[model samples]
Target: MGSVFHGDITVGYEDEGSGEALVLVHGHPFDRSMWHPQTEHFSRAGWRVIAPDLRGYGDSTAVPGTTPLAAFARDLAGLLDHLGIERCVLGGLSMGGQIVMECYRLFPERIRGLVFADTFASAETADGKAARYAMAERLLREGMDGYAHEVLAKMISPATIAARPDVAAHVLRMMTATPPEGAAAALRGRAERPDYTGLLSRVTVPALVVVGAEDAYTPVGDALDIHERVPDSRLTVIEQAAHMPNLEQPDTFNAALGAFLDALP
Candidate 1:
Protein backbone atom coordinates (compact mmCIF):
# COMPACT_ATOMS: atom_id res chain seq x y z
CA MET A 1 0.00 0.00 0.00
CA GLY A 2 1.17 3.54 -0.80
CA SER A 3 -0.14 7.09 -0.20
CA VAL A 4 0.11 10.60 -1.63
CA PHE A 5 0.09 13.80 0.40
CA HIS A 6 -2.32 16.54 -0.71
CA GLY A 7 -0.84 19.32 1.40
CA ASP A 8 -1.71 18.82 5.09
CA ILE A 9 -4.20 16.17 4.05
CA THR A 10 -2.80 12.67 3.62
CA VAL A 11 -4.94 11.13 0.87
CA GLY A 12 -4.98 7.53 1.99
CA TYR A 13 -4.33 5.50 -1.17
CA GLU A 14 -3.09 2.06 -2.06
CA ASP A 15 -0.79 1.90 -5.08
CA GLU A 16 0.13 -1.65 -5.94
CA GLY A 17 1.76 -3.58 -8.86
CA SER A 18 3.86 -2.05 -11.61
CA GLY A 19 2.40 -1.23 -15.03
CA GLU A 20 0.02 1.31 -16.55
CA ALA A 21 -1.89 3.15 -13.83
CA LEU A 22 -5.54 2.19 -13.18
CA VAL A 23 -7.34 4.45 -10.70
CA LEU A 24 -10.63 3.40 -9.14
CA VAL A 25 -13.00 5.95 -7.60
CA HIS A 26 -15.88 4.72 -5.48
CA GLY A 27 -19.35 6.20 -5.40
CA HIS A 28 -21.32 8.27 -2.89
CA PRO A 29 -21.40 6.92 0.66
CA PHE A 30 -18.74 4.37 -0.25
CA ASP A 31 -15.12 4.15 0.86
CA ARG A 32 -12.14 2.83 -1.05
CA SER A 33 -13.05 -0.64 0.21
CA MET A 34 -15.89 -0.54 -2.25
CA TRP A 35 -13.36 -1.33 -4.96
CA HIS A 36 -12.02 -4.47 -3.29
CA PRO A 37 -12.80 -6.73 -6.28
CA GLN A 38 -11.43 -4.22 -8.79
CA THR A 39 -8.32 -3.49 -6.75
CA GLU A 40 -7.38 -7.13 -6.30
CA HIS A 41 -7.95 -8.10 -9.94
CA PHE A 42 -6.37 -5.06 -11.60
CA SER A 43 -3.29 -5.03 -9.37
CA ARG A 44 -2.59 -8.74 -9.75
CA ALA A 45 -3.04 -8.36 -13.52
CA GLY A 46 0.01 -6.05 -13.52
CA TRP A 47 -1.63 -2.60 -13.46
CA ARG A 48 -0.61 -0.10 -10.81
CA VAL A 49 -3.98 0.08 -9.10
CA ILE A 50 -4.76 3.24 -7.16
CA ALA A 51 -7.81 3.52 -4.96
CA PRO A 52 -8.49 6.47 -2.64
CA ASP A 53 -11.09 7.26 -0.03
CA LEU A 54 -13.11 10.21 -1.20
CA ARG A 55 -13.40 13.07 1.30
CA GLY A 56 -14.95 12.06 4.63
CA TYR A 57 -15.65 8.48 3.50
CA GLY A 58 -12.67 6.46 4.81
CA ASP A 59 -9.38 7.09 6.61
CA SER A 60 -8.54 10.06 4.43
CA THR A 61 -9.81 12.81 6.70
CA ALA A 62 -12.20 15.40 5.32
CA VAL A 63 -11.29 19.06 5.30
CA PRO A 64 -13.37 21.98 6.58
CA GLY A 65 -14.91 23.36 3.39
CA THR A 66 -17.33 22.64 0.57
CA THR A 67 -16.78 19.07 -0.62
CA PRO A 68 -18.44 19.30 -4.02
CA LEU A 69 -17.89 16.60 -6.67
CA ALA A 70 -15.75 19.05 -8.68
CA ALA A 71 -13.51 19.41 -5.66
CA PHE A 72 -13.47 15.63 -5.56
CA ALA A 73 -12.09 15.64 -9.12
CA ARG A 74 -9.40 18.11 -8.13
CA ASP A 75 -8.56 15.90 -5.19
CA LEU A 76 -8.14 13.01 -7.67
CA ALA A 77 -5.83 15.11 -9.83
CA GLY A 78 -3.85 16.09 -6.77
CA LEU A 79 -3.55 12.45 -5.79
CA LEU A 80 -2.24 11.46 -9.22
CA ASP A 81 0.24 14.33 -9.22
CA HIS A 82 1.35 13.52 -5.68
CA LEU A 83 2.08 9.97 -6.79
CA GLY A 84 3.92 11.15 -9.96
CA ILE A 85 1.43 9.48 -12.32
CA GLU A 86 1.22 11.31 -15.65
CA ARG A 87 -1.41 9.35 -17.58
CA CYS A 88 -3.71 6.50 -16.59
CA VAL A 89 -7.04 4.79 -16.97
CA LEU A 90 -9.75 6.34 -14.77
CA GLY A 91 -12.99 4.66 -13.76
CA GLY A 92 -15.79 5.79 -11.47
CA LEU A 93 -19.12 4.42 -10.28
CA SER A 94 -22.32 6.41 -9.63
CA MET A 95 -21.28 9.72 -8.07
CA GLY A 96 -17.70 8.65 -8.54
CA GLY A 97 -18.27 8.61 -12.32
CA GLN A 98 -19.23 12.27 -12.16
CA ILE A 99 -15.95 12.93 -10.39
CA VAL A 100 -14.09 11.07 -13.13
CA MET A 101 -15.80 13.18 -15.81
CA GLU A 102 -14.77 16.29 -13.98
CA CYS A 103 -11.25 14.91 -13.85
CA TYR A 104 -11.39 14.33 -17.62
CA ARG A 105 -12.63 17.87 -18.16
CA LEU A 106 -9.87 19.38 -16.04
CA PHE A 107 -7.02 17.10 -17.07
CA PRO A 108 -7.82 15.48 -20.41
CA GLU A 109 -4.22 14.65 -21.16
CA ARG A 110 -3.89 12.34 -18.17
CA ILE A 111 -6.69 9.95 -19.08
CA ARG A 112 -6.10 6.75 -21.06
CA GLY A 113 -9.53 5.17 -20.76
CA LEU A 114 -12.92 5.81 -19.14
CA VAL A 115 -15.34 3.56 -17.27
CA PHE A 116 -18.64 5.08 -16.14
CA ALA A 117 -20.79 2.63 -14.25
CA ASP A 118 -24.22 3.48 -12.89
CA THR A 119 -23.70 7.21 -13.33
CA PHE A 120 -25.62 10.04 -14.96
CA ALA A 121 -24.74 12.86 -17.32
CA SER A 122 -27.08 15.09 -15.37
CA ALA A 123 -29.02 14.77 -12.12
CA GLU A 124 -31.81 17.00 -13.29
CA THR A 125 -34.47 16.50 -15.98
CA ALA A 126 -37.77 18.15 -17.00
CA ASP A 127 -38.64 18.74 -13.33
CA GLY A 128 -35.38 20.64 -12.93
CA LYS A 129 -32.91 20.16 -10.02
CA ALA A 130 -35.65 20.05 -7.42
CA ALA A 131 -35.57 16.27 -7.24
CA ARG A 132 -31.86 16.26 -6.54
CA TYR A 133 -32.21 19.05 -3.97
CA ALA A 134 -35.15 17.28 -2.35
CA MET A 135 -33.12 14.07 -1.99
CA ALA A 136 -30.40 15.93 -0.15
CA GLU A 137 -32.92 17.74 2.02
CA ARG A 138 -34.53 14.44 2.85
CA LEU A 139 -31.20 12.91 3.85
CA LEU A 140 -30.42 15.91 6.02
CA ARG A 141 -33.84 16.08 7.62
CA GLU A 142 -34.66 12.37 7.93
CA GLY A 143 -31.08 11.17 8.55
CA MET A 144 -29.47 7.90 7.47
CA ASP A 145 -32.08 5.55 8.87
CA GLY A 146 -34.80 6.79 6.55
CA TYR A 147 -32.37 7.46 3.75
CA ALA A 148 -30.93 3.98 4.07
CA HIS A 149 -34.32 2.33 3.95
CA GLU A 150 -35.40 4.30 0.92
CA VAL A 151 -32.19 3.75 -0.98
CA LEU A 152 -31.76 0.09 -0.06
CA ALA A 153 -35.21 -0.65 -1.37
CA LYS A 154 -34.30 0.98 -4.65
CA MET A 155 -30.75 -0.39 -4.91
CA ILE A 156 -31.54 -3.87 -6.13
CA SER A 157 -34.24 -5.62 -8.05
CA PRO A 158 -37.11 -6.75 -5.80
CA ALA A 159 -36.33 -10.35 -6.80
CA THR A 160 -32.70 -10.00 -5.76
CA ILE A 161 -33.63 -8.25 -2.51
CA ALA A 162 -36.09 -10.99 -1.55
CA ALA A 163 -33.68 -13.80 -2.37
CA ARG A 164 -30.80 -12.32 -0.34
CA PRO A 165 -31.87 -10.18 2.57
CA ASP A 166 -28.56 -10.65 4.33
CA VAL A 167 -26.62 -9.27 1.41
CA ALA A 168 -29.08 -6.42 1.14
CA ALA A 169 -28.70 -5.68 4.82
CA HIS A 170 -24.94 -5.54 4.50
CA VAL A 171 -25.23 -3.16 1.58
CA LEU A 172 -27.68 -0.97 3.49
CA ARG A 173 -25.32 -0.84 6.45
CA MET A 174 -22.54 0.36 4.18
CA MET A 175 -24.58 3.39 3.06
CA THR A 176 -26.14 4.09 6.45
CA ALA A 177 -22.78 4.41 8.16
CA THR A 178 -21.69 7.15 5.79
CA PRO A 179 -21.65 10.54 7.52
CA PRO A 180 -24.65 12.60 6.35
CA GLU A 181 -22.50 15.58 5.40
CA GLY A 182 -20.58 13.75 2.69
CA ALA A 183 -23.72 12.23 1.26
CA ALA A 184 -25.57 15.54 1.20
CA ALA A 185 -22.60 17.35 -0.31
CA ALA A 186 -22.52 14.77 -3.10
CA LEU A 187 -26.21 15.29 -3.87
CA ARG A 188 -25.67 19.02 -4.06
CA GLY A 189 -22.82 18.51 -6.49
CA ARG A 190 -25.00 16.37 -8.72
CA ALA A 191 -27.69 19.01 -8.90
CA GLU A 192 -25.05 21.62 -9.72
CA ARG A 193 -22.66 19.89 -12.15
CA PRO A 194 -22.43 21.19 -15.69
CA ASP A 195 -23.81 19.07 -18.53
CA TYR A 196 -21.14 16.56 -19.70
CA THR A 197 -22.59 15.87 -23.15
CA GLY A 198 -20.42 18.50 -24.83
CA LEU A 199 -17.25 17.02 -23.43
CA LEU A 200 -17.88 13.44 -24.60
CA SER A 201 -16.97 14.27 -28.18
CA ARG A 202 -13.46 15.37 -27.27
CA VAL A 203 -12.99 12.22 -25.14
CA THR A 204 -11.66 9.76 -27.73
CA VAL A 205 -10.28 7.31 -25.19
CA PRO A 206 -11.59 3.75 -25.14
CA ALA A 207 -14.55 3.74 -22.77
CA LEU A 208 -16.98 1.37 -21.10
CA VAL A 209 -20.53 2.32 -20.14
CA VAL A 210 -21.82 -0.18 -17.60
CA VAL A 211 -25.31 -0.12 -16.17
CA GLY A 212 -27.52 -2.43 -14.14
CA ALA A 213 -30.51 -3.92 -15.94
CA GLU A 214 -32.77 -2.78 -13.13
CA ASP A 215 -31.06 0.51 -12.34
CA ALA A 216 -34.00 2.83 -11.91
CA TYR A 217 -31.78 5.62 -10.58
CA THR A 218 -29.68 5.94 -13.73
CA PRO A 219 -31.80 4.85 -16.65
CA VAL A 220 -30.51 2.19 -19.06
CA GLY A 221 -31.36 4.64 -21.83
CA ASP A 222 -28.66 6.97 -20.55
CA ALA A 223 -26.07 4.23 -20.64
CA LEU A 224 -27.11 3.43 -24.21
CA ASP A 225 -26.67 7.08 -25.09
CA ILE A 226 -23.21 6.96 -23.59
CA HIS A 227 -22.40 3.94 -25.69
CA GLU A 228 -23.68 5.56 -28.86
CA ARG A 229 -22.08 8.92 -28.20
CA VAL A 230 -18.64 8.05 -26.93
CA PRO A 231 -16.53 7.41 -30.02
CA ASP A 232 -15.03 4.14 -28.81
CA SER A 233 -17.30 3.07 -25.97
CA ARG A 234 -19.33 -0.08 -25.33
CA LEU A 235 -22.26 -0.69 -23.01
CA THR A 236 -22.85 -3.78 -20.87
CA VAL A 237 -25.74 -4.39 -18.53
CA ILE A 238 -25.76 -6.78 -15.59
CA GLU A 239 -28.99 -8.59 -14.81
CA GLN A 240 -30.56 -9.02 -11.32
CA ALA A 241 -28.77 -5.84 -10.34
CA ALA A 242 -29.72 -2.24 -9.81
CA HIS A 243 -27.73 0.87 -9.05
CA MET A 244 -24.81 -0.87 -7.36
CA PRO A 245 -24.27 -3.74 -9.77
CA ASN A 246 -20.69 -4.15 -8.64
CA LEU A 247 -21.95 -4.94 -5.15
CA GLU A 248 -25.08 -6.89 -5.99
CA GLN A 249 -23.49 -8.85 -8.86
CA PRO A 250 -19.76 -8.62 -8.45
CA ASP A 251 -18.92 -11.82 -10.33
CA THR A 252 -20.80 -10.69 -13.41
CA PHE A 253 -19.36 -7.20 -13.07
CA ASN A 254 -15.83 -8.56 -12.60
CA ALA A 255 -16.16 -10.84 -15.60
CA ALA A 256 -17.23 -7.94 -17.79
CA LEU A 257 -14.35 -5.86 -16.49
CA GLY A 258 -11.84 -8.65 -16.97
CA ALA A 259 -12.94 -9.13 -20.58
CA PHE A 260 -12.87 -5.39 -21.27
CA LEU A 261 -9.43 -4.86 -19.77
CA ASP A 262 -8.09 -7.96 -21.43
CA ALA A 263 -9.32 -6.77 -24.80
CA LEU A 264 -7.63 -3.40 -24.38
CA PRO A 265 -4.56 -3.22 -26.59
Candidate 2:
Protein backbone atom coordinates (compact mmCIF):
# COMPACT_ATOMS: atom_id res chain seq x y z
CA MET A 1 0.00 0.00 0.00
CA GLY A 2 1.22 3.50 -0.92
CA SER A 3 -0.06 6.85 0.39
CA VAL A 4 -0.03 10.42 -0.93
CA PHE A 5 -1.62 13.43 0.73
CA HIS A 6 -3.84 15.79 -1.24
CA GLY A 7 -5.17 18.37 1.20
CA ASP A 8 -7.23 16.36 3.73
CA ILE A 9 -7.56 13.37 1.39
CA THR A 10 -4.95 10.64 1.69
CA VAL A 11 -4.90 8.75 -1.62
CA GLY A 12 -4.14 5.06 -1.06
CA TYR A 13 -2.71 3.13 -3.97
CA GLU A 14 -0.80 0.03 -5.06
CA ASP A 15 2.52 0.69 -6.77
CA GLU A 16 4.55 -2.22 -8.12
CA GLY A 17 7.23 -3.30 -10.63
CA SER A 18 9.78 -0.96 -12.17
CA GLY A 19 9.42 0.15 -15.77
CA GLU A 20 7.24 2.40 -17.93
CA ALA A 21 4.19 3.51 -15.97
CA LEU A 22 0.72 2.02 -16.43
CA VAL A 23 -1.75 3.85 -14.21
CA LEU A 24 -5.16 2.24 -13.77
CA VAL A 25 -8.27 3.67 -12.14
CA HIS A 26 -11.13 1.56 -10.85
CA GLY A 27 -14.83 2.36 -11.28
CA HIS A 28 -17.37 3.82 -8.90
CA PRO A 29 -18.33 1.80 -5.85
CA PHE A 30 -15.10 -0.17 -6.33
CA ASP A 31 -11.65 0.10 -4.79
CA ARG A 32 -8.19 -0.26 -6.36
CA SER A 33 -8.44 -3.99 -5.71
CA MET A 34 -10.69 -4.28 -8.75
CA TRP A 35 -7.55 -4.03 -10.85
CA HIS A 36 -5.74 -6.83 -9.03
CA PRO A 37 -5.48 -8.98 -12.12
CA GLN A 38 -4.15 -6.15 -14.28
CA THR A 39 -1.76 -4.94 -11.64
CA GLU A 40 -0.23 -8.39 -11.20
CA HIS A 41 -0.03 -9.09 -14.92
CA PHE A 42 1.32 -5.75 -16.15
CA SER A 43 3.81 -5.32 -13.37
CA ARG A 44 5.32 -8.74 -14.11
CA ALA A 45 5.52 -7.78 -17.77
CA GLY A 46 7.94 -4.94 -17.01
CA TRP A 47 5.64 -2.00 -16.29
CA ARG A 48 5.25 -0.01 -13.13
CA VAL A 49 1.57 -0.46 -12.30
CA ILE A 50 -0.15 2.16 -10.18
CA ALA A 51 -3.72 1.56 -9.08
CA PRO A 52 -5.28 4.09 -6.70
CA ASP A 53 -8.35 4.05 -4.53
CA LEU A 54 -10.28 7.10 -5.60
CA ARG A 55 -11.49 9.55 -2.97
CA GLY A 56 -14.10 7.84 -0.83
CA TYR A 57 -13.19 4.29 -1.85
CA GLY A 58 -10.75 1.67 -0.55
CA ASP A 59 -8.05 2.98 1.79
CA SER A 60 -8.40 6.64 0.67
CA THR A 61 -10.04 9.51 2.51
CA ALA A 62 -13.68 10.03 1.68
CA VAL A 63 -15.00 13.54 1.10
CA PRO A 64 -18.63 13.84 2.18
CA GLY A 65 -19.99 16.16 -0.51
CA THR A 66 -20.02 15.83 -4.25
CA THR A 67 -16.62 14.88 -5.78
CA PRO A 68 -16.33 15.96 -9.40
CA LEU A 69 -14.72 13.89 -12.17
CA ALA A 70 -12.11 16.62 -12.49
CA ALA A 71 -11.24 16.14 -8.82
CA PHE A 72 -10.58 12.44 -9.50
CA ALA A 73 -8.53 13.38 -12.56
CA ARG A 74 -6.50 15.91 -10.57
CA ASP A 75 -5.85 13.35 -7.87
CA LEU A 76 -4.47 10.98 -10.49
CA ALA A 77 -2.21 13.68 -11.92
CA GLY A 78 -1.04 14.55 -8.45
CA LEU A 79 -0.27 10.89 -7.74
CA LEU A 80 1.86 10.77 -10.88
CA ASP A 81 3.64 13.94 -9.80
CA HIS A 82 4.35 12.38 -6.43
CA LEU A 83 5.84 9.34 -8.19
CA GLY A 84 7.88 11.54 -10.54
CA ILE A 85 6.26 10.03 -13.63
CA GLU A 86 6.29 12.54 -16.50
CA ARG A 87 3.80 10.52 -18.56
CA CYS A 88 2.01 7.18 -18.53
CA VAL A 89 -0.39 4.87 -20.32
CA LEU A 90 -3.58 5.69 -18.42
CA GLY A 91 -6.35 3.11 -18.26
CA GLY A 92 -9.68 2.87 -16.45
CA LEU A 93 -12.87 0.85 -16.24
CA SER A 94 -16.49 2.08 -16.02
CA MET A 95 -16.64 5.44 -14.16
CA GLY A 96 -12.86 5.31 -14.02
CA GLY A 97 -12.86 5.39 -17.81
CA GLN A 98 -14.68 8.71 -17.73
CA ILE A 99 -12.14 9.98 -15.22
CA VAL A 100 -9.33 8.92 -17.55
CA MET A 101 -10.98 10.89 -20.31
CA GLU A 102 -11.18 13.81 -17.92
CA CYS A 103 -7.44 13.41 -17.30
CA TYR A 104 -6.79 13.58 -21.02
CA ARG A 105 -8.92 16.68 -21.20
CA LEU A 106 -7.06 18.35 -18.35
CA PHE A 107 -3.49 17.26 -19.13
CA PRO A 108 -2.99 15.54 -22.46
CA GLU A 109 0.76 16.01 -22.26
CA ARG A 110 0.94 13.69 -19.28
CA ILE A 111 -0.74 10.78 -21.09
CA ARG A 112 1.03 8.49 -23.52
CA GLY A 113 -1.84 6.08 -24.24
CA LEU A 114 -5.40 5.41 -23.07
CA VAL A 115 -7.48 2.34 -22.24
CA PHE A 116 -11.24 2.96 -21.91
CA ALA A 117 -13.07 -0.20 -20.89
CA ASP A 118 -16.83 -0.60 -20.50
CA THR A 119 -17.58 3.13 -20.50
CA PHE A 120 -19.20 5.78 -22.69
CA ALA A 121 -18.48 9.42 -23.46
CA SER A 122 -22.02 10.82 -23.57
CA ALA A 123 -23.24 13.38 -21.06
CA GLU A 124 -26.00 12.53 -18.62
CA THR A 125 -29.49 12.85 -20.06
CA ALA A 126 -32.16 14.63 -18.04
CA ASP A 127 -33.77 11.34 -17.04
CA GLY A 128 -30.37 9.80 -16.25
CA LYS A 129 -29.44 12.83 -14.14
CA ALA A 130 -32.65 12.50 -12.15
CA ALA A 131 -32.07 8.76 -11.71
CA ARG A 132 -28.54 9.37 -10.41
CA TYR A 133 -29.76 11.97 -7.91
CA ALA A 134 -32.48 9.59 -6.78
CA MET A 135 -29.97 6.78 -6.37
CA ALA A 136 -27.72 9.08 -4.39
CA GLU A 137 -30.55 9.92 -2.05
CA ARG A 138 -31.43 6.26 -1.71
CA LEU A 139 -27.80 5.35 -0.95
CA LEU A 140 -27.68 7.92 1.85
CA ARG A 141 -31.12 7.02 3.17
CA GLU A 142 -30.32 3.32 3.24
CA GLY A 143 -26.78 2.06 2.73
CA MET A 144 -24.64 0.03 0.35
CA ASP A 145 -25.78 -3.38 1.61
CA GLY A 146 -29.11 -3.53 -0.21
CA TYR A 147 -27.89 -1.70 -3.30
CA ALA A 148 -24.86 -3.97 -3.61
CA HIS A 149 -26.99 -7.11 -3.54
CA GLU A 150 -29.40 -5.68 -6.10
CA VAL A 151 -26.76 -4.56 -8.60
CA LEU A 152 -24.44 -7.57 -8.50
CA ALA A 153 -25.85 -9.17 -11.62
CA LYS A 154 -25.80 -5.90 -13.53
CA MET A 155 -22.22 -5.15 -12.52
CA ILE A 156 -21.15 -8.52 -13.85
CA SER A 157 -23.22 -10.92 -15.95
CA PRO A 158 -25.63 -13.41 -14.36
CA ALA A 159 -23.52 -16.11 -15.96
CA THR A 160 -20.44 -14.74 -14.30
CA ILE A 161 -22.17 -14.50 -10.96
CA ALA A 162 -23.08 -18.17 -11.10
CA ALA A 163 -19.98 -19.55 -12.81
CA ARG A 164 -17.31 -17.51 -11.07
CA PRO A 165 -18.32 -17.35 -7.43
CA ASP A 166 -14.96 -15.91 -6.39
CA VAL A 167 -15.15 -13.04 -8.87
CA ALA A 168 -18.78 -12.39 -7.97
CA ALA A 169 -17.93 -12.36 -4.28
CA HIS A 170 -15.06 -9.92 -4.78
CA VAL A 171 -17.25 -7.57 -6.80
CA LEU A 172 -20.04 -7.75 -4.25
CA ARG A 173 -17.62 -7.24 -1.39
CA MET A 174 -16.18 -4.09 -2.96
CA MET A 175 -19.63 -2.60 -3.52
CA THR A 176 -20.89 -3.57 -0.09
CA ALA A 177 -17.82 -2.14 1.59
CA THR A 178 -17.92 1.19 -0.21
CA PRO A 179 -18.84 4.21 1.92
CA PRO A 180 -22.39 5.21 1.04
CA GLU A 181 -21.57 8.87 1.57
CA GLY A 182 -18.67 8.66 -0.84
CA ALA A 183 -20.65 6.67 -3.38
CA ALA A 184 -23.53 9.10 -3.12
CA ALA A 185 -21.21 12.06 -3.46
CA ALA A 186 -19.69 10.52 -6.60
CA LEU A 187 -23.16 9.92 -7.98
CA ARG A 188 -24.13 13.57 -7.48
CA GLY A 189 -20.91 14.84 -8.99
CA ARG A 190 -21.01 12.41 -11.93
CA ALA A 191 -24.52 13.70 -12.71
CA GLU A 192 -23.16 17.01 -13.93
CA ARG A 193 -20.36 15.60 -16.15
CA PRO A 194 -20.03 17.15 -19.62
CA ASP A 195 -20.18 15.14 -22.85
CA TYR A 196 -16.82 13.66 -23.91
CA THR A 197 -17.88 12.64 -27.43
CA GLY A 198 -16.20 15.65 -28.99
CA LEU A 199 -13.31 15.38 -26.61
CA LEU A 200 -12.51 11.87 -27.91
CA SER A 201 -11.83 13.26 -31.38
CA ARG A 202 -9.01 15.41 -30.11
CA VAL A 203 -7.20 12.57 -28.32
CA THR A 204 -3.59 12.76 -29.48
CA VAL A 205 -2.40 9.48 -27.97
CA PRO A 206 -3.07 5.91 -28.97
CA ALA A 207 -6.34 4.63 -27.52
CA LEU A 208 -7.83 1.17 -26.95
CA VAL A 209 -11.58 0.88 -26.41
CA VAL A 210 -12.75 -2.43 -24.98
CA VAL A 211 -16.14 -3.76 -23.87
CA GLY A 212 -17.77 -6.97 -22.75
CA ALA A 213 -20.26 -8.55 -25.10
CA GLU A 214 -22.69 -9.01 -22.22
CA ASP A 215 -22.15 -5.61 -20.65
CA ALA A 216 -25.45 -4.22 -19.37
CA TYR A 217 -24.21 -0.73 -18.50
CA THR A 218 -22.13 0.49 -21.43
CA PRO A 219 -22.93 -1.76 -24.37
CA VAL A 220 -20.79 -2.58 -27.40
CA GLY A 221 -22.37 0.35 -29.28
CA ASP A 222 -20.88 2.75 -26.77
CA ALA A 223 -17.41 1.31 -27.32
CA LEU A 224 -17.93 1.49 -31.06
CA ASP A 225 -18.96 5.13 -30.83
CA ILE A 226 -15.84 5.94 -28.84
CA HIS A 227 -13.61 4.01 -31.24
CA GLU A 228 -15.08 5.87 -34.21
CA ARG A 229 -14.54 9.23 -32.62
CA VAL A 230 -11.00 8.73 -31.36
CA PRO A 231 -8.55 9.43 -34.18
CA ASP A 232 -6.05 6.76 -33.14
CA SER A 233 -7.95 3.90 -31.56
CA ARG A 234 -8.77 0.20 -31.67
CA LEU A 235 -11.76 -1.73 -30.34
CA THR A 236 -12.09 -5.17 -28.78
CA VAL A 237 -15.19 -6.94 -27.47
CA ILE A 238 -14.56 -9.79 -25.05
CA GLU A 239 -17.07 -12.62 -25.23
CA GLN A 240 -18.87 -14.16 -22.23
CA ALA A 241 -18.09 -11.19 -20.02
CA ALA A 242 -19.98 -8.19 -18.74
CA HIS A 243 -18.98 -4.80 -17.33
CA MET A 244 -16.13 -6.15 -15.23
CA PRO A 245 -14.28 -8.19 -17.83
CA ASN A 246 -10.97 -7.50 -16.22
CA LEU A 247 -12.13 -9.82 -13.45
CA GLU A 248 -14.78 -11.92 -15.20
CA GLN A 249 -12.25 -12.90 -17.87
CA PRO A 250 -8.83 -11.71 -16.80
CA ASP A 251 -6.77 -13.60 -19.38
CA THR A 252 -8.70 -12.20 -22.34
CA PHE A 253 -8.71 -8.69 -20.90
CA ASN A 254 -5.03 -8.88 -20.03
CA ALA A 255 -4.14 -10.25 -23.44
CA ALA A 256 -5.86 -7.35 -25.18
CA LEU A 257 -4.39 -4.86 -22.76
CA GLY A 258 -0.91 -6.36 -23.05
CA ALA A 259 -1.05 -6.22 -26.85
CA PHE A 260 -2.04 -2.56 -26.70
CA LEU A 261 0.75 -1.68 -24.31
CA ASP A 262 3.26 -3.57 -26.45
CA ALA A 263 2.26 -1.57 -29.52
CA LEU A 264 2.32 1.79 -27.82
CA PRO A 265 4.94 4.31 -28.94
**TM-scores for every candidate against the unseen true structure:** 0.90, 0.99
For candidate 1, lDDT tens digit of each residue in 82-182? Answer: 88899988999888888888899989899988999998775456455677677777777777787777777677777778987866876777688776766
Residue 13's lDDT in candidate 1: 77
Sequence-dependent TM-score of model 2: 0.99
Top TM-score prediction, candidate number: 2
Q: Which regions of candidate 1 deviate over 4 angstroms?
A: 1-10, 63-65, 126-128, 164-166
Candidate 1 matches the true fold with a TM-score of: 0.90
Candidate-wise lDDT, in order: 0.80, 0.94
Best by lDDT: 2
Model 2 agreement with the true structure over 97-169: per-residue lDDT tens digits? 9999999999999999999999999999999999999999999999999999998998899999889999999
